[model samples]
Target: MFTDKLREGSTGPVAKFLFIIIMVSFAIAGVGSYLTPKMDFNPVKVNGNSITNGELEQQFRLEKNKLERQLGKAFREQAKDPAFNASLRKQTLERMITDQVVSDHIFNSGVVISDDLVKNRIREMPEFQVNGKFSDAQFRKVLSLAGYPSPLVFSEALKGDISKEIYLKTAFDSGFALPDDVAVMAQILSQERTFSKIDIAIDAYKKNQTAGEDEIKAYYDSHSKDFLLPEKVKVSYIYITAGDFVNDVKYTDEDLKKFFDLHAELYTIPEKRTVSHILITGEDAEDKIAKVAEELKGGASFEDLAKKYSEDSSSKDKGGKLPAFAQGVMDSSFEKAAFALEKTGDVSEPVSTQFGWHLIRLDGIEPGHGADFNQVKDDVIEQYTKVQSRELFMDKKQIIADTSFENPDSLDAAALAANAAREEGGQVSKSVQIKTSDFIANGDEKAAFPLNQPEVQKVMFQSELRESPVNSDVVELGDNAIVVVHVEGYQEPAPKPLSEVHDQVRDAVLTAKAENASGATLKSVTDSLAKSESLEKYVKDGLIVISGPATISRIKTGDVDAQVASNVFAMPTPEPGNITYKSFAGNNGSSYVLVLSKVVDPKLGADSARDSFLNNQIYNFRYGEDNQIVINSARAESKVEYNENREYLKMQEEQNN
Candidate 1:
């Protein structure tokens, strides 16, 4: 899809930026001084450029976040494993080292991006824009949120990415698909197969099969470890959440008024202005703007002139009408010009912004308003409760954490300390209480809230905590919810007696026997088919059912078993008027003897659109392969040094141990 867009000349600055995002580790484009070798620990050095421990950690966090989002709930279990985190860190470090090597190569290659291109790309980025135009305030606000000290820092980072993008684009262009490649892809995608299946149900094979006492005993003895119960723990804990204090928060009308007065600006709505413009950009913009101004001066309808000549594609079709916007949402110059208009239908002199020159006209305005005390009393009470509860929650959480650690044997002191903190904050005291949990076994998904939380489960089952029995360090269930647990009772894993597991062991042995019987039957059928014999006798005995012949294509493999369909297309084509047989074990304890009777190769069509699509598909695949090769080659040739004792990396190892 991306290759097609690129070929069609539709890929622009935004696409390029998305394609090669800034490599955060080596983004010091103009800030070379920050890259000077320091006494600080380095995790890896690529071609004399050191990747600091801090940079490695930052990149690791970003990569981890991306993975968590991509994997969603499935990543939660993996995140609890320290080993997975260590592996992620190693991968992150390797990527950063590769980026550093690429950054060095780009710098040494003398690639220079023109100033105008950089400025234009920056202005085009949606993150730095408001109302479809560049906004200095939004740009700086995003930079600050992203932890960049200033615009220069973020711009330098962006410039580095842009430079690397040049090299990547060249690499991508090196790949091309020939006519033969397109033909092959089209054939593979459009080929069809017709096959029949001999279905052998495992249960049918197992009808006369049975496991004896000896077989059950043997299986039980061999897999005793699998029969053991998981270790279990019952814990008493005291937890605090922001919501816990919400009801206890008492406030008077005077207090609400005080809060309302303190945050008066937040309650005031900013004035809104509806405006339109004729934007003249690109070659001879000044001349175009002057022409627009002259036409407007000659009593030309502003809307008509805007529809005729405005270069802002987003608004031109609507007579250059922009959505009503308040302060800080438009280019500073544009906002000033529109707001300075004295009345509706007033036109302003031509105004200039980073985008272009524009003639502005005000269409309508909505004056700002502030709510009186009584008008928003309910809102004030809710906001005040939220603020007070959050403060009290944090205070109680701190007291609980400290008290719990000091008195590690019980949650009583911790609970009392939390209550005291609430009392001190003028909240209802003794609302916080210690709660006991039912015995929670390892990997127990049914455990109730707090216990069901993996963080809490991890602490509850700790060897030290279970044996020594201490109040656990505060475990945060979420941003504002935390719990401190003390082991009240514990049980170690133990094997179930053979007598108690006799039925389970017998079932396991019977399953194994059934699987063997099913395999033997499939083998017998395959051997019979190989000898040009038929399964008429077995079919009569009801041991096998032959499914009707069905046709399948790569794009339309209708109603066929997924496993059967996958293997059907991959099987070698038989000679004309010959049958081929392949056997497979089904996921549900069944077996299949696939009878492939025909293979249809796609005939090449004269469809130009489909040919282009196939060509682009192959081109994209080749481009990705070549891009990876370039990166791999750079990595293999780059001189990289690893700091085995970097303190940041050591922490992961220590945690896993």
Candidate 2:
């Protein structure tokens, strides 16, 4: 706690921001005033300040966007929870309320936010920075998206946020954790749970209890919809894919020969040449060339002359070297001159191309060889497949669709006519679940087309069930695969009969009774243990007793069940000399009775290993609670009142709906 960076007399803006963050566990920014104008039709009021409905909705939407970004695709699942959505709305509204509360406190407390500070804060914001400087364009673009139409309008909100930060900074800076309180908290946080647990597994009672026929019937009568299936279909589909006929459509030697004859260019490997170059072309090119030729005739080495006088940036070092090249990679004149050389060590006179003059040398030559049928059999087969498939895919696809739509019956006839059809059957529910396989071939999840795609589920579940399963129009999985679904069987949602769901009902009845029995058993055991102070008898009676991990000082115990840990902490600390005991329900369909025989305070050195007293954890926690008290005081002093306009209630109702 004493080693925290946010200490007294720190003047850095960054440090100041951290202090405020620690204040209320909230990032409150800006100070002084509300941004929108007060009006008679205001929907919400905080600290006597009226906030317009439009402003509330705008803030709500901004918060909603942030939540969606955090949630990603999971937001779709969360949206289904009314409680979560309600909490989301409540938190957003509460944020607006908190803003007003904090703003009032800031103004009364004499906290100030200046234009320069606001501008500096904006410029430092990563969203508005381009190439490490504040970009006006980026700032405006962000504002436009955020529904802040003008820089002026956004400045007000920014100013308000800064004011709140200042108010919190003052409050947090004044907070102090007393030495005695720190000792007690540290001891509690570092205490370990040295106790053993007795688990009452639900399975143990299964043999002793059974849901009789009448009980099963009675349970089913009351909870019929529990067994009612969402909507299911038995589908028989014929999948037509390139994979289906890749092996069947074989390429023979004769076929390969014909294919080779048509696309023979692709098989021909062009001749390659190994070459090197040097160039001398500047102001005195003609004069320099004659001197170079004279020096070459006088036995001056070509490499030496090139190194001393060549102007070419490339190949100037390492005595001029170039990679071997094919004909088309170089300029025509250069290619011709280089290829014209009969042997290695041949040199050509300086020749000009687009990149200035060049002194060409032929280091080596490699003759080109055209691949025969035996050398490229795989290529021939692949080319043949691609060519054939391209020419035939459209026709095959259309014919499959036409036949299935026209007949609405046999997939057998369609299979005879297209790429090839393979029969597949499965049950589908309301969504994309198709009983799938882990097996994959060539990186493809080998689900026959219909069940693999969710789009088909949307179609099939919406379509009326047929008595005699028949094919529907083709549903294309992708460009390469297509299939037609036959609704062979279906079961509509209904109250399931006791005979049909007898086993399920029996299990449910048993589980429910087991849970109740476990709860009752737990109460009885805990009562007996507290009175008798002995767990040995219960431990002997098939209650699997195991010692739990050291957890009091532990902040993160991922291996332990969260519910069990929470219940354990919620257990009262043992009376001065006596141990404490409690009962908790386990998520594994079991009951647990935990005994806390001791509170093991952590052993520490001057340079502590434990974190309870480090990082200002206790001080920060107390500050947040104290900061809330200050905010409440400010809000209560304001004498706030709500207009409760009809339109405001209607707006909220519509939003909830």
lDDT of all the models against the reference? Answer: 0.77, 0.64
Cα lDDT for residue 489, model 1?
93
Flag regions of model 2 displaced more than 4 Å: 1-94, 104-148, 169-186, 228-493, 512-520, 531-552, 556-558, 572-578, 587-590, 608-615, 630-657
lDDT for residue 404 in candidate 1, whole number 0-100: 88
| Residue lDDT tens for model 1, 1-657 | 988877666478775675455444346453354566444467667787788777766766656666765676788567654446666777887777776776666676677777778889888775565444677866775555445556775566677779877877765564567877778878888888999889886566667678888888889889999899889999898877788988778888789999999867557665688999999876478898998899889989888998999988999999989999886578988887787786888888889886779999889988767879888888888889999998888888888879988988898888877776333455448768999988889889798876876656877888888778788877655335677788989988998998999989887887788787767778889999889798898888777889979999888888887878998877778889888989876787666888899999867767655776777678778767765775777777789987665553443333231
lDDT tens readout by residue for model 2, 1-657: 665554644778887786777664433533312344443666667755677767776776676666665676797456544345546666777777777777777787888788999988887665564323566976775666555658987888899878876767666663555655666665666667655577875665565577788888888888988877455666666655544444444456898899988776567675678876777664457677777777877888778877887776677775667888765467866776777677789888777765556777778777766788878888988888877654455566676677766676666555554534323442211111113223212112244444644545544554543554466655554334555666666656666666888888999988887777667667767788779656566566654455664455456545666676677777777866677877665666576778876766676444332332443566677667767887788777765566666655544533441
The 10-residue segment with the lowest total lDDT in model 2? 426-435
Clashes of each: 0, 10
RMSD of each: 16.9, 25.9
Scanning candidate 1 in windows of ten residues, the lowest lDDT window is 648-657
Q: List the residue pairs that clash in candidate 1.
A: none
Winning candidate number (lDDT) = 1
- TM-score, model 1 to reference: 0.64
Clashing pairs in 2: 29-161, 29-162, 30-159, 30-160, 30-161, 30-162, 30-163, 30-164, 31-160, 31-163
